[model samples]
Target: MTARIGVVTFPGSLDDRDTQRAIRVAGAEPVALWHKDKDLKQVDAVVLCGGFSYGDYLRAGAIARFSPVMDTLIDQAKAGLPVLGICNGFQILTEAHLLPGGMLGNDHLHFICRDQKLRVENAGTAWTSDYSAGQEIHIPLKNMDGRYVADPRTLDELEAEGRVAFRYLDVNPNGSLNDIAGITNAAGNVVGLMPHPEHAVEPLIGTGRTDGLPFFTSILKKLVNA
Candidate 1:
């Protein structure tokens, strides 16, 4: 059966449509989910694409975490549902406590946009199995608040548990601790990343690279085999 993946769209969401397109390209069905809706529509997986949800007025994802959609998403995610958060979505995951740590403004205090290279650190997560550990891939990243920070203990725990899913390669654009670009939960069912893989999925679009296609493909494979 084809996997049905849901893309949540909050107010001001800029990448929801692109995320849907990428999901379609991956040979899966893309289901549009609304932030105000409490239902998940039985999607096999969920992807929170980038954008300034809630206008980023209240410390990025702070306000959106309290949305009705997140109420269900948080509970379902803890129950082993696969979820991927990109950029602003990553911020929401952290704010929702589905993922650890939190995002801060760019260390430079400026919004950044770039084609970023990252190394896959953990390929066992539901969202990253299509990548190999240590494999380098480029994905477009753009955000005002992108720095990832955590306490020393949590940082050590993440490193020891192999939960640091992706690390920035070449240059650290956001001054994130240890150059972390993405991370997965201990269960590996939830992941949060600062890059925009949906933007890199189509070869004819921005960056013109299909490196991000694997993220969608990997989830499809996991769901189909489940």
Candidate 2:
């Protein structure tokens, strides 16, 4: 059976369509999941795409974290369901405590959008298994609150457990400690990042650099071969 990947749409989601397109391009069925829905529709995996959910009012992802779907997502993720959170989705993951740390405003105090260089520090995670360890890729990143902050103990634990999935390669745009860009949960099923991978999956796009395509492809491959 073809793998079904769910792309969630919150009230203010901006990249739900793009994420669904990327999943379809990767040979998976893209299922549109509503924020209020309790059923996952049996999607093999889920992608929480980027956007200013809930108008980003209280904070980037504060309100969106309480969405009803996230309640199910949090539970399923603990049971090893594959979950990928990108950009504002990453913010939601942190806010929901699915992932450690929190996102703060950009250290530069401005919204940043650029093709960012990131090293795949941990290729064993569910969302990044297609990449090789230490491999570098350039992907589009855009956000106002992209800086990842964690306590010293949390940082040390992540580093020690090899849970740091990606790191800034050349320059840290938001001054994320240790140049962290992405991380995974202990089971490797939940992954979160501040970059916009769905935007970088198409070749016809700028630079024709489809560096982020691997993320979608990896999940499909994992599901198909399971």
Candidate 3:
């Protein structure tokens, strides 16, 4: 059966359509999910696309963390449902406590937009299985509150357990602790990242690089095997 991937669109979301397209490009069915709706439409997996949800009110994704959809998402994720969060979506995951750490303002205090370099730190997660550990890829990074912060113990645990799925390479765009660009939950089913993979899935667009396609394909493979 073809995998059905849901893309959630919260208020002020700007990349839901792009995420859907990337899912389709990866040969999966794209399902649109609303932030206020509890129904998942039977999607095999979910992606929280990047955007300034709630206009970044009350700090980045703070307000959106309590959305009705997240109520279900949090439960499902704990039950082994595969989920990926990008940019502001990453912020929401942290706020909901589905993932560790928090996203703070960039150290430079600027909304940065650039093609970023990252190293795949973990290859066993549901969303990163297709990538080899240490593989370098480029994806677009754009946001203001993009710096990832966590306590020293949490950072150590993440690193020791191989939950750090991606690490910034070359230049650290937002001064994220330990150069973390993305991380996976202990179960490895949930992943969140600062860069926008949906924006990098097509070779004819943006940076003309398709390095981000592996993320969608990785989940599709996981669903098929499951």
Specify the highest-lDDT model's number. Answer: 1
TM-score of each: 0.99, 0.98, 0.98
* Descending-lDDT candidate ranking: 1, 3, 2
Candidate 2: give its CA RMSD in angstroms.
Answer: 0.8
lDDT of 1 by residue, 124-217 (tens): 9999999999899998999999999999999999999999999999999989999999999999999999999999888898788899999999
**lDDT-best of 1 and 2:** 1
Q: Candidate 1, TM-score vs. the true structure? A: 0.99
- Runs of candidate 2 with Cα error greater than 4 angstroms are none
- In order, the Cα lDDT scores of the candidates are 0.94, 0.92, 0.93
Q: What is candidate 2's lDDT per residue for 1-226, written digit by digit as tens?
A: 7999999999999999999998888888999999999889988899998999998899888998888898898899889999999998999999999999999999999999989999999999878989999999999989999999999999999999999999998899998998999999999999999988888888899447889989998998898889
Clashing pairs counted in every model: 0, 0, 0
User: How does residue 147 of candidate 1 score in lDDT?
Assistant: 96
Clashes of 3: 0
* TM-score: model 3 vs. ground truth: 0.98
RMSD (CA, angstroms), candidate 3: 0.7
